[model samples]
Target: MTPSAVANLAGASPLPAFAPRPRSRPNSASPGPFGPAPRRLAVAAPPRAFFSSAPYQPPEPEGYSSVREYGLVPMVVETTSRGERAYDIFSRLLKERIVCIHGPIADETASLVVAQLLFLESENPLKPISLYINSPGGVVTAGLAIYDTMQYIRCPVNTICIGQAASMGSLLLAAGARGERRALPNARVMIHQPSGGAQGQATDIAIQAKEILKLRDRLNKIYAKHTGQNIDKIEQCMERDLFMDPEEAREWGLIDEVIENRPASLMPEGLSAVDPPHHGGGAGANGRGRDRDMEEPSAV
Candidate 1:
């Protein structure tokens, strides 16, 4: 063959053949609309309850069905629940021939004092009993109950004022003692006419007002008799609350003497001075202490 024909034949090697790349398969376990079949996962089943189980049950009631069924037990619990310390102190004082009227004068308190006084009087009629008063005063009737009992008892009652004696407390201080009423040097005393509110018809309210006036007159007479003050002057002074220091109280005949130095025997073993006034209803009615503005009339 000629040289040109040989060159053409050499250059005429066939063009290399092209092949398409293979596509990758989708993962069977992956989540997709057009994915391959899913692979099963090995998961353990929950344990059966046949061996041990408890059925669902409703809760029990939280409160009692009838309070009356428990009777006075609940009342006793309630009274002592908050006043355990006071009750303990009171019991100790009673054993020591002492009666502490440390809060407001109230019906329940009067009853308690009266009962204790009677018991003590029965035990030893001639023994000298100490009546410790530190109050802002309360219901006049309740105070009068204690006052009358104090007077009726055969034992000699020595009233001692510590922090304060005001309104009904003043009455108790004056009438609860036999001869001389005493006060701490820093004690305060107050005297005022009985006060209260009446809710009723107009006529009934007027009647209640008249009754209160009459009760006030009786109280004035009692104060006058005890303090040697003229009833008229007492009435005048009592028209508004009159506060006095210990000396002034003594001068006014509210207290016979001011205790300059308290005897060790006068206080409890652990106490230094008088106990601070407890805030809640102590051993008194409504579980509350005295309120100066709300002092009620004796006859109410």
Candidate 2:
């Protein structure tokens, strides 16, 4: 039987069907099902306000400022992905003619450091660019890419070795602007022949071996030229991993000063000197990984 017919038979009248009423325009101050809707707050000059634990205020039409800049009148400016920190000391150093390479080198990182070098050159060619390095090593081609760009730029790259510059890192430390290459008293430097592993067929392995030899010869010459040593001497020195303390590095023409005399000039401004990269590599952009195997046949 139909529901309506049954209902009429059982009772006096059929039950009315539910029909929802169309809601008209909501009131500006109506208490909603979830309590009163929060009014859009307008932050004034001095009276600071907090609503929920989320967005500081509605994004302004002009721009947005980061929470990092809460010291002064918050200028709401949109943030960017250029670098992680808004007011990190490293970010500040980048602005002040300082570029740091504190880990293993790679194409993307080398590209960024190269771009920073170029941009700083465009800003002021005569000013010196400080390059703080604390790295183990990385792909030969990547390091060379940065090395070539450093030479191409007009501004001098004043390299400073903080902890250790090894393999390709040591090459960069030596290639910095002459006389300005300096290292902390206890910093270490190392240079060794490029090492790599080859996969694939026997013929391919042979080809890779030949290329490694050529790379070794070329690297020897580069070291000799920069260190003022003969090619033979450099080749012999690099046959095994040659380690050097700052003093010994100076004697080997790797760095100009051991930084023993200058206590006050350790940092440029009042900012404290940055700590060097720790022993085991971390997730920092530059210290990600060691890709020495890919350095076998470095690209031109």
Candidate 3:
């Protein structure tokens, strides 16, 4: 009825009241005649089937195994390890003044090559830079980008052909410092006219065609200048894909000689022919490189 009574009723919950817990009395009968009952001994619990785990196993040295997990982290670690090892070798190579161009020439490859060449020249203009080539050749402009840099640098670039130097690759071999182009025994070289596949409107195609002709002529001149061949003869030879072995390449001026024994020059002390002082590396130099001689790292 009053305000306090109304507030108390409003605050109360509508749940039923709980019953208080009942109490139990102790046994009235005491330990009479025997004083107390005999007690039983406690028994222990049996052990569970918790078998021990198998012994630790190491990862495979080489590839992988189906029994084990091969996750992204392991794969990434492997790749990074390989890359680091390769880079160590490359740094060793740069220190030794050796470079390589061993893939299809392209803008990316050419850019790296140019940078290496320039850097090498700056490192020591007197020390020669070796440009090893094993490519099938690619973009004419890209190839020229390297060739132009080779000429621009003050250092002499000694180019060595390992597997093959086809088309622009062959031209680069010839473009090396006079008397420095050399190929491994059994290595092959190829030469051909500049090739193009222009696709566009008729007028644009015509203009591209003209430019290709100009490139061809310019390349012919470059070959002539480097190989000491007559422009007419070079042009005639370039009419088709002309592949030549080391000996033939040498005779044709694509290379100066075919190497059999390891080069004695630049061979550091205690650097055996069997295990040459070498490590893998990446690109740099005045971009001093074989035109993208941006070729991947050859096995050291």
Candidate 4:
């Protein structure tokens, strides 16, 4: 029977048939059937090649190489590698006829002084060279080298003692300036016999002792020549360290004059003036006060 006739007979209306929904195909821009699409993270790839293709190597060391396959290595390495500025400054000072001996007297120091004195003598024999000394003293042989050179050189060397001149240093100062040695009012002076050591067999030690005696006698004669003191008296005084103030040094004929003023030419540029030694104070730069306790009769 027709649904419309049946409905009319039943006095009821037929309901409209429902349509089915269409299924969607999976796509790149669309979500999956399960839900929303999962996110994908980007990753970077490692490089296959380096900028340098050569095998790794270390840089070569510069200047001197202390390493050696065998033999003894030096405990100390002497180098003259100074900055250009220092070289320039020293060069200028050399031209000014002013040289400084501000440290211990030693072979190296004597060499430098000898070189400068020789140069000055060759350049101008009459040119006056001023040597400023402030040392506690050192090797006797080294000081003697400088002393003999000062007398041998034709150039007039004016030694000004700005601080303490001890042991062989005193001899050098007294011998300089051709008996015209000058000392600062606060300077100190000391003289003592040269001390030495011998390490060997019995005969070798005896020989060294004889040599030391001869050296001491020679030094005594030199000191006597510069100062009017009798050789015997000077020898006796040198047996024990003889300490003297500036005034006492002048009276002893170790120095000619005690100057109160420091000449501009004598002072080095860029250096501050040193304060005078205190009368009853602590040690000064030249070790004026400490000599009584600390002074030793070593090589100087």
Question: How accurate locally, in lDDT, is each candidate?
Answer: 0.70, 0.73, 0.70, 0.70
Q: Model 3 compared with the native: what TM-score?
A: 0.61
- Model 2: colliding residue pairs: 63-76, 64-76, 64-77, 65-76, 65-77
Q: TM per model?
A: 0.59, 0.60, 0.61, 0.59
Candidate 1 weakest ten by summed lDDT: 48-57
| Candidate 4: tens digits of C-alpha lDDT, residues 220-247 | 8999988889988897898878899999
Please list the residue runs of candidate 4 whose C-alpha ends up more than 4 Å from where it truly belongs after superposition. Answer: 1-89, 263-300
Tens-digit lDDT track of model 1 for 55-131: 11233367733222335421111123445222343565576688877666655677888999999899899877888
Write one digit per residue (lDDT tens) for candidate 2, span 1-300.
999998878886466778899889877599999898787887534322221111123433555323223254222222455533244445556667889887666665688789999999999998888898998877787788899999999998899999999988999999998888999888999988887655566776677778778888888888888889998788788888889999999999999887743222334443332333235533333333221112112222
Q: What TM value does model 1 have?
A: 0.59
Lowest summed lDDT window (length 10), candidate 4: 47-56
User: Could you tell me the lDDT of residue 198 within candidate 2?
Assistant: 59
How many residue pairs in model 1 have overlapping backbones?
Answer: 2
lDDT value, candidate 1, whole model: 0.70
Error of 3 at 34 (Å): 99
Cα deviation at 16, candidate 2, in Å, is 58
lDDT of candidate 3 over 33-138, digit per residue (tens): 7675555678645322211011113333786432233232111111343473334444556656887686666666788789988998998988788898988787
